[model samples]
Target: MADYYLAPDGSDSNAGSSSAPFASLQTLLSALEAGDTGYVRGGTYDESGFADGSDQHGTASAPIRLEAVDGADVVFDFGSGDTGGLRLWKCSHWEVRGFTVRNAPSYGVYVFGDSTDVTVENVTVEYSGGDPGTSGAGFHVRVSANTVLRDCVSRYNYDPSSGGGNADGFAVSQATDTVVEDCVAYGNSDDGFDLWESTGQRLSGCVAHSNGWDLDGNPAGDGNGFKLGGGDVPSGGHLVTRCVAYQNRRRGIHYNTAEVAMEVYNCTAWDNPTNFYFTAGEHVLRNNISSQGTVNIQDPVDDAWNSWTLDVGDPDFASTDPSSSKFLHLTTGSAAVDAGTDVGLDFDGDAPDLGAFETDGGQDVTSNVNPVLKAATPTGDGDLAFTAGTLHYYDGSRWVAPPVSYYDGSQYLTVSEGVQTDAGLVDGFERGDLTPYAGDLGSFNVSTDRAAEGSNALKTAGGRSAWADIRSTEKAIPHGSTFQARVYFTDAADSAILRFGVADQDNWLGAGYNSNESGIQLSESVDGSWTELGTAQMTPVTGEWMTFRVEWGVDDPDQIRIRCFDADGVELGTGTTTTSANQGNTGYGFEYTFQYGGTGPVYFDDLRIV
Candidate 1:
């Protein structure tokens, strides 16, 4: 039994022993259905979490391979176990080259795969485990088909859940014509390469950075150091080119709704809290190079920093300063080199600049999503099915509930670009951070900390901002949910909480516990004169960001529907109530806080909730 044995041979280590080979790769998969081309010649083979070879061995025509001697580098170490490192279940024409599959608890080479035509080149899946409850991942390809993950290199991988959850370096699910080329997903917490419910996939010259943004809390937000997208459906042609995502928490190249003929060329994204968070599919982004913060495109140009056919500066890469001196440099008379625009760019020779620093002269905020008269937030939960008009609905358990955004107004208008004015004289501009800047779209004129110091319209409050604040978590939102805000009530009594529901469940103040403890049963009354007095229905939790709506059918979850519209969409109050979610009833939980004060003027949009 001597094909080339070594592991302390007592013999029959499946006959490939000069020594005593075959120490368990399932004893060479029980000697692979009766050998055809067996060669574990060199040694060290234990790729367990590598999907324990999912369906076990294969034969599209006698296809069972494991190489490393044509140029030796084989090193399957999987020291810990629970999942993948080598699993190719119903394998076909399988091929693994110049091996080095590390730590294998999760993935180093897992193609549990069916009908497999796998070919993993120059592979290297390192340090898996980024802590969001820790499950381990460096390569998790599900529903595999026509797979090819080339030139790999997955690094650090540590986000078990600081705010973010889990880690990923390469995830292509529901695969089809898949191709991941010239890869490199660094630090890893989330997307370094992710294409969900995959179809025709293609990623070229890839590069992902510090990686990981725990979202829902705004872990950092941004996906595309290669992140195609999914969930709201859509997703067909997946293609990403010349990539480079720096600081990495958001967009270096991203798509949300499944995405269609997706395309992002000559890429380079900056500090990336958000360097472009796209959702509209059938996508196409021309020559890219975006700089320091914000580039959310929906295609409605007015000022992406400097108005452009292409060309919005500063991506002198090699340094966003991760220290060593520099880390994202590319500056030298930069306007993104020569400014972009060669369209669908052909592997850069020149002409290309939109995002991912090709010499980033990037700063076309596209007007921070510019488009004022705001109120658009239904990326999904129900895929966006809102419009009851007063704020309320009940059909799940029943007990009556509807005011469709509740409002009994006198006057309110908040379709803004006009920053501080609702009369009552002053005070009203604050900056970002609330769930990543409250639905962020545009119009960011900043400051007005609390207004009143002298109140000259609160010193123009930053310059121009509609208003911002929408942060609450520790998740527990029951009863009907609908919260809309774009507001205007020009007299004085201006209020906001388009949707704040959770009528019962312990005071939601989570930093150390604060109190007034927002248990707001219901509130909506932005008076300057309109009347159903807006809504504060089923309000529970202390995290303030008012505009209201809640739908879970029935008034028990503390029943809610506090809507307020008056710009010719009138219906200020046709009330309905039944509040009590029991956090011990105690104190201020808002049976009313839609603030029914004086000076009037209000407006708000997309209040939230299916």
Candidate 2:
């Protein structure tokens, strides 16, 4: 067993001791033997990358450990276009903790190719990918087994290429028995947690929000909060529980076209395109809450006691605002409180709350005296009990106060002298018996008649002369800026109008496909008056499906572009319109309307809002 030291001001030729440390972590890692420990002092190391191949693998009994020095902040700034930061390839039995990786052009911490028993804790990866960068994901694990990431944060990772489609906060591909707990992913350009072709994975006590967009408010990527599965084959029977996803650009918890069954429990989703879009898999969803969003469930064996199934209106959350400290917690008199079936998980009430946080006498509070003196005190691990008078807190053992505040990227905020807010556990369950198809306030029907791609399509009741509308409420377009919506429509009516409407804007942006004339027109309405911007000639045949696309504010912020394509993807017509100052430019919500001159129905399919 040996101990090594690394510091920014040290030299590699000196002895790797505390007094004379090495200059780089790569030098120290190369010199480490089994049962060796390396301590990196507080400083920024501007390096390209660090990797340990299979030849440097450590034994289980004598693992290699690398950690930041106590009471120090170690940062690795891999500036622009580096392949990776802190890479462990085909190695085993390694422990890494307490470090920050910033400005990585690609992945921050990459463990790939048969690495086993690798544990990472209290690490923060931020600003991972940007312009002039390639596709990257923070904390990427591929084909690695027995990997654990605890109390980590992946934030603000973006990939400018592919419109920020490939960058994710945490991506695990074909990793077996990987566990991610007490982690947070925010402001990522793609999905928060993407499990692509990954099996034997478990995600718990994780928070993912504000993904699928960049900091500048540009909408891009799939924007799913938790994308459970994807790839050529259906590759997941993953366990996801006690997770919270909100304000994501797309689905809060998306199955992502996986055919495998996923077990999701005690999760909360809000302010997303669709809270739970489990259309492609046999998912089991229970005790989950879809507050302020839509739910689309296709095939599920066990779906019961969910907020949508129970019809428990609003969950009466403690606070709907994410800026509040008590966001998404079940409050007093909430219908979701104690409305769950015991699924062998811990709870505060007679039963578990419908969502993530259980309100045990309000976990967040400030008191003058000791909270233990109160009749109902906090017992959860992350329960906050701060005494203003004594400036002390219960660290799950005793009351002690630290000198200064320190965030080591762990479950709790630590301070000097190793004082923690509470026990190590941080922000801290089954799916059930029901039919395949479900319904919500939108009253959308799954029809097997005509579909653009899938086996089923959404159908609405026919309207005589008035417009029948289907609006996805709470599905706000990111920044209300540029986006593209595509839908396929077909009907027997000779004269019909299919239009996509912005949520609250009174003006009609344009008609998606108007068969009244032999042309397609993009128009804007001001003061109930319509003005055409551009038009293209095309005559459509009745009873044939055609694709309609609307590109809103794409090139110009106040512009609307429309395109029509035949079933074979050949362009039929195109139109462009730029809105004036009188017309609203920014719109978050959206809807679609269908109107036929005859008393009949128009079928729509494969609706995609991106």
* C-alpha root-mean-square deviation, each candidate: 22.4, 19.6
Q: List TM-score per model, in order.
A: 0.30, 0.63
lDDT values of the candidates? 0.45, 0.68
Local accuracy of candidate 2 as per-residue lDDT tens digits, 1-610: 9999999999999889999999976788888777999999987788775444345677889988888886466888776444656788877899988888877777788888889999998788876775355556888999899999987888778777667898899999988999998788877889899999987699988888889986444787889999998897657798998888898998899887766787898899988889998876567888899987898887554678889998887988877645334667767788888888887667876877787766655552321111222233455886755432224578789986533322222112444343334322111000010011111214345456655543555555444343333332222232223333334444433333333343223444555555444467665555556566667776654456676667765677676677777767788777776665333322222223334443334445544454
Model 1 deviation from the true structure expressed as Cα RMSD, one decimal place? 22.4
lDDT of 1 by residue, 562-594 (tens): 443344445333234443432221111111122
Deviation in angstroms for 130 in model 1? 8.1
For candidate 1, which ten residues in a row score worst on lDDT?
403-412
lDDT at 35 for candidate 2?
90
The list of candidate 1 runs beyond 4 A from truth reads 1-50, 54-86, 89-105, 108-135, 140-167, 171-178, 181-202, 205-210, 213-265, 268-286, 293-311, 314-610
